[model samples]
Target: MSNKIPYVNILQSAICIPVSDEVPIALDIKILPDKNIPAESFFGVWLLDVSGSMGGDRLENAKESLIEQIGILPDGTIFNLITFESKVNEIIKDVKITNKSRQEIIKKIQGITERGTTSLYTALEKSLEILRKYSRTNGSLAIRKIILISDGEPTDVHVRSGEENDPNYQKYFMLAKEALEYKSSIDTVGALGEHNVYLMYEIAKLSTGKYIFAENEEELKTKMIIATEQTARIAFSSPTLAVTSITGDIELEDAAQYKPTVIRMPFEKINKRESKAYLRSFEAGDTYQILVKGKIFIDKNNIQTETNVKVLELDFDFGKDGLRETKEIFITFSSDSSKFKLNQDINRKYANVFSQAEEIADCTIRGDAAATQKIQGDETKKID
Candidate 1:
């Protein structure tokens, strides 16, 4: 294992697995930000919903939270703030925070009031536009994030009817796709349990971001801070893990991420023997665990011989930084069954992840949106 990389660490559940028809493997990867790195590398666009529903404590709390976030942001951090109701308003644009501008930004946030209906999609569209434009001059290494906070469903004519087929609703997903093009993830916070849960969840998932539910009005501030803090700690952007079967006969099957929120990850198959899993931005002091399943075909004649076999190779890619390191995994074949040992912790995690996945699927098929949201919310809380 190459340990030269100081920013990230990778750990596996077992160095060896029993040589059988199929074996499971798990990797616990931890990424730590270098404190010496400049904070200017982080860029954020915050979308605050000022729809009429946000008139009272909701709006006030949001303002306070935004102000608090601004106050705590390290000097030289680049951020933009936008508020939307029936119209999209850009309160600040491409502002790099410093001692002089911090107080000015807070005053602008405090002046925000609520009116009109929620233009959720419009707000998202505008924010992504700003980030996309900024990325052109600033480059891709910066940690780009969009934090959207809303207390109610979208009130746009095409989306308010709850029709998925509406062109505007489809456009919402397209916006998320566009976000990926700019290497930006949209983290969403559904405040007061009234926002469209499925919409918030899907957009965040599609963008490889987090979806947080502030169950009550008071929790919104905390959740917003949590989201901001996570983005602030991003050490590496667009991290991907590529697994290759070196032995040719070991067919890589499926993979899923079990930590930092349990959701099925899109496992891209490069070939029958190789696959890749794209992870969200890596944050300092945060660990991500992934479980990969594979099938190994042992030669009938060779199975009788006790030998060590090289099974898999992992290549870690850190966005614009390219492939940082590689690790190879091996397993042993032996006639003595006593040599076989199982990593119970990994097994349990695999079981729990798949179980939750199945429950989500069933809920979706039954058109139980509430149940699906509940399962997702419960899984998210587990990581907290």
Candidate 2:
């Protein structure tokens, strides 16, 4: 019998990070051949503090970031929103990421009044409960986590700010522990230089997640972007296929999720190397197909003049696995030929993401909820 070598479909994971307002980075996270992800699915929890302290542009920026965050989410992310202050509110009770519901949710967010004392602990408790309602054990996806945005500590009488005053602190600690124990990432986004940044950091550490401090509205935008990128790295940076080529078509789509084609990835991390691979910027109209995406420019006009532009490209024979485990990949914007040439052997420079998918493939995607997987052994048992 002639031996046959089946063309193994080594699946890849993609993650899109929408920073507060910086360059949007979508990374192709590499994983081994064993872990294959399907087309599109996203799962996450958003826990925000709407206390009076988080008013004005701070709240506005948070909403903006939420839109960006939600915009890139694939149809699969069974996301739920938790906002808190004196009390906690669930904006969208475990809803899938969609245009209509997300718009309605954003409108609800717009009506959020920043009133009442900050109740960080209470918020955490209640939000955790809301998330629990959507937990994997309860039939939610496995690749899930929490995003906590706040600028203060809990005002709950039970918990102490420090180890010094009280037994109630232990209870609060347990509450935090329980939430994290359930395998959910807890990323913290705090106001830049706010006195409560320390608390945010502490919470991040407790949750084994990312801590991001945004100093201003602009930085908040950037931080939001960074936060999303970081999440992408963590969730999707696992791929086996190495990209032999990359090109950017200079395109601008409004923050709205509807009218544009999207790249969906599960998770992405920032501080780590090899996790940063993104589609570069190029205008399809400015340059034709063969030369549309391979060069870098300080200015758009440079394209016509064809000045000193940076060129990076990838040409690899990664065998069956497509991508290797290397920590870096170079960028290649389709070039115009006649003018500029390639520069220093540059690798896709990876950077820090202080802070952090779509669709319905209908199959088991990577990080999917095991609770949804049944049919195990000799006997019959239910999944979840």
The candidate that wins on TM-score is 1
TM-score of each: 0.80, 0.49
lDDT of 2 by residue, 1-384 (tens): 001111221111111111111222222222212222233443567877778888888878887887776766666567677788788777776777677767776676667667776777776777677667666456545445677777665676444333333566555546555655565556666664442433554455345454555657766656665555445423222111222222222221211111011112212222222112222111111110100112112233223232222222222222223333333333222234443233221112111111111221111122121211111100011111
In candidate 2, stretches whose alpha carbon ends up further than 4 angstroms from where it belongs are 1-40, 157-169, 236-384
What is residue 172's positional error in candidate 1, in angstroms?
2.9
Return the TM-score for candidate 2, rounded to 2 decimals: 0.49
Model 1: which residue pairs collide?
none
Instruction: Specify the poorest-scoring 10-residue window by lDDT in model 2.
Output: 375-384
Residue 375's lDDT within candidate 2 is 12
